[model samples]
Target: MSPAGASLGATVLCVLAWAGLAAGDRVYIHPFHLLVYSKSSCERLEKPTAEPAPHPSLTPAPIQARAPPVDEEALWGQLVPAAQKLEDGDQARVAAVGMLLNFLGARLHKTRAEMRGRPGAAVLSPTAVFGTLASFYLGALDPTASRLQAFLGVPGEGQSCTSRLDGHKVLAALQTAQGLLVARGRAGGRARLLLSTVLGLFTVPGLRLKQPFVQGLARFAPVTLPRALDLATDPDLAAEKINRFMEAATGWDLGSPVMGLDPDSTLLFDAYIHFQAQMKGFSLLAGLRDFWVDNATSVPVPMLSSTGTFQHWSDTHSNLSVTRVPLSDNAWLLLIQPHRASDLPQAEALAFQYDLPMWTKNLSPRAIRLTVPQLALRDSYDVQDLLAQAKLPTLLGAGANLGGISDRELRVGQVLNSILFELKADEEEPPTESARQPAGPETLDVTLNSPFLFAIYEQDSTAVHFMGRVTNPLRGV
Candidate 1:
């Protein structure tokens, strides 16, 4: 117990403690390390040889700027003259066909751009392009066997075009284009439908004579044309029939919905066919049932308030009334904003809070309107006058949550569930003695489940437009 012995022991303890702290800090501060694979093998490893010298004619040329590709311009040049000829007899049909073709070409360009990691332009939405394409085919395009075979380049016995290089060339080009579209992952389902439909129209006996379109329109009325009767009444059945035709025509099972389709694959197939038909100036709606309208149902909601004063707050709001609409089992409370007071913060807040969650991934703003007073005197208005003048829809629709909200109060505005929490190794706990046990085949299992909210918002503003609760949220969200 001498004083010098005590001091020396204390100094040793302090040094060890400091060293441990430094190690802990280093662990926390360390940069992430990425493992890189070595190119060379251990056996017979050698440095790479220098690249072969360029040929005399292929020597490094001076850099020169080149004009951007003008594929669209060239396509238009070929199309305009053909369109003019078609217009001579059926001007409306020709115009419709031209629009469909334009849409198809645009879709093709968009798909190409997406494949090459380019941003898609907003000039044409995919739905509009596909819809228009569908319309053109149903409205203007003939389903004659000769025309169908010629357009698609499919060969048949006694088909003289198949024997020629020109026929083969066009057929190869069409197939190549179709293959490229089918490879795109986003639009597979629509593409599959389009391709199957086209093939059905072409190869199915008597379909080219317009019976299928007539049947399809009658069955699926308003969404599809009735030119082909067989396809109109039972579109899904028609799709199945088309599948059979494709199998017969190509000698391959193109696969059926009964067999599970990977969603990504389906999207690519759908996009391919849609783009192709569009390119050929086909109208999707001409013979198809109105999917959007047919699928929509009036959602129901509890009446929160029914004060007439609320409705008559603005002149625009005078006619506004509340109504409920269903969005799945979940009822949506849609408060249609009035035209004059549409920009009011209160209206926006109400819509964002209630409407967005129920209709997330489905509903979109139907319209937007603005009004400005010309005179300064007119601008100064009472609250009652302003409210009365508001033209927005006062109607509200309600729906069920559809597993969107948790019982627990979540972190305000936190859009994602399952927030990652790093439990750092305890700094102060003493290391435990190593325990050993008899070892054999062992199984380790882990399970995690947490309820949390997710929100979708405009990219620029952090304001949440849509919110939902994830029951089985994906990992690393």
Candidate 2:
């Protein structure tokens, strides 16, 4: 038989064997024996027996009683007023503000989890915390009033402070969850830091005392929302301000640039100066500004001096100048100074050389003396393309497939064989010179009806250099 035919036969036998195993314990009879039995006795094979079911009384019993349903409306009625009062009361009256905010945040998180298909939490936890804090600071809640009397089966003026206190408790839980999520990189860490800082400002009195320094530091905080949203959401602003204050107080700059300077570089002189100021309990803003000025004088090369020009001061002034050369789309070139005749010939032999794409001359030069014009970077994929790529099963399931495949059964060397067989028989070939050429790379689709069966043949082909199967030609087996 041909190789393909042999492969097909082998695949059929393997599949039948697999199917038999899948069917569980079963007797196999030879064709001759079956024929002899049929001829001697006109009786068919006996049917298999079924297992008996257990008695209802003997089965495991279910729980008898359940907890009573919570009265959500009554609970809400009790909680809302206290929450409002606590939010509207003076800061002095609401001493345990952190506990209150945290409680509300937790409740919000639980509400969010309950609403599985919803976009956000039923109660906006952050907003609730902000509102509660605002209410307390604004003096809406009075300490003399009975805030919990109406909700807990107690008869009074119907003001339930417990409800408001619950809101704060929920808020606290939500904040904890948020912290965990941010730490895991699920939520933005920077945003979380800012939020924490803002909350700290309200809870920590000493930080707010130095408002000007805090505000200055806040200016450098990452812009979470646009200017309009920033103004509308007071919590966001407060959070950013608090973040700035914390960073300043700790002598750490969260907004420091990541790429440019080496860790040991003198450019961090400003950071050192700020650290000294922080140690002495000086105002952060003034210290930072002074540090920058001092650093500019100390390390002139790294600092951008106010000379109305962008220039890097080198250690040695040579006749030859170093200029940046633009390479291709994603490359850069630095042209070193060419030595003069007075200098050693070795100096002209190129002080530094690095491998880069040879197509560096294609980029146009910018008019600025020492600056390169911004390159118009193009995205490799459009929105539709990105969405389609994201939806593909192959990329999503690659990890699972890798985990399941045994190295002994399937080696990387057999991948090419699998790919070749994976190509369908009816798949159109690449256009030749005689045929009308395709504008782009030709694409083909291969569908597998039974991928597991094909995988067995693929393993066989990898183990032994032979074509696997043609059991389902249309399915690319």
Candidate 3:
């Protein structure tokens, strides 16, 4: 399969393949077995099985902090070819993962808005969040894994091994999806995108992590940093140490101190992503623009201006308009802005209710002079908190089976993922002569001067990679 086709197939298989096979006594299954279907596997599925045997708790292997994993290529090689046959009944499940991310993204923004008691800037990543959950799924066994698979929209087949979903396939699909984004960014000389992901794991002293589990993380994050610290001693000190380590590793000061540290917790997980996209069509405006934060208040922020024919749609029933702009050959930025009279929160609530993917499909080309604020946004939230918001707080609780990750009982304190999205106008070259045409009677001026919602989509799969709300352009830089 071509690289592009492989990415699309992988994205489509994320959820469907998870429901393919159940976990037997084995801890890890090669993603290849789950992705590539054969007559032999089908025949095995047809056979009846005796009573299921309980798998003993897996033994954790000791390894030093920042140790290089052995056989990295062998583990990652399974994700290649990327394309796999997706059953007809399971096709819809292909989009299940993306839709879940959309729902969570909406919830994430809503939660932030409620916390501040006002509209606020928030950014959530579908890829990072999905990958983080999938990584945990790799370490989860039986009931915990089943719960995760269900939440991820994987359908239950049966009680046999063939009925269980493979965590490796889910993770491999995540890698391909992310790879597609990176590959898209590299094409088209006029555009540039920088996306980097890092996973940070902090463990209590003498607590060992499974080597296989750590090795599997290579499917998504290129860098995995594991450190052992005295988390039970002083929460503040521990937080400081974690912050310093992450900052040094990623060169991003997360600003706020890490919160919700449990003294008795043995493990903490944090995933960080830095994403920046720049395209040639838009040019930075010389002066700041007034962005109304509310009916009466406004803030001055940097702005970018672009004039050309672009995909655009105005929702007649609702007080919002949708605009789609190409960031790369394989990606688009869809902007949803509310009318001047409507508040963003109400518009956001209404916007999420509509089929978001349809917005991209329904867009029509129109001549537009678009003005949007230069954005630099960041937000971090705990996965546990997100589950609580989803009313599944105990999904990762003490009783959860994470034996694949470690042998001893573990208290997982936090599962946090931080996202940073930066969109800047490329000013290296002037706009093409056609784009610089003087405003005419047919040109419509659309300015995102107020709080609005935005989503980044992978063109091939039409999957939402990132969803966010921009209340103030300068808030989370």
Candidate 3, lDDT over the whole model? 0.67
Q: Pick the candidate with the highest lDDT.
A: 3
lDDT of 1: 0.22
Name the TM-score of candidate 2.
Answer: 0.16
**Residue-level lDDT tens digits of model 1 in 302-402:** 11111111111122333222222221121121233223322332333233231232223333322111110000000000111111122101100011111
List, residue by residue over 1-477, the lDDT tens digit for candidate 3.
644233333433643443242223223234233432245665775667796444343222222333443232322233323324344523233344445455445555565556556546777786777788878878998777766655554433234455556666566656655555545454344227666777888888777787778888877677787788888889887877787667766666566547658888888888888777885579877667799888899999988888888899887677788998888776788899987545577777776531356545668999999988888888887887766655566668887889888877878888988887888877564533332444788998988888888888765444577877887887872
The best-first sequence of candidates by lDDT reads: 3, 1, 2
Clashes of each: 90, 39, 4
Which residue runs of candidate 1 sit more than 4 Å off their true CA positions?
1-96, 115-245, 249-477
Error of 1 at 266 (Å): 16
lDDT of each: 0.22, 0.21, 0.67
Encode model 2's per-residue lDDT on 1-477: one tens digit a residue.
Answer: 644234334433543443345235333221111111132232322233485332121111111212233232232233223323333322222222222232223332233333333221011222223332222212112221112111111122333322223322323322332222122111121111111121111221111122222222221111111111121234444335433443343333333211122221110101100100000100111111111112122111110111011111121444333333221111122333222323312322222111011112233333222211111111011111211222322111122121111111111110000011111111122212221222334321111111001100001001110111111222221
Give TM per candidate. 0.17, 0.16, 0.79
Candidate number with greatest TM-score: 3
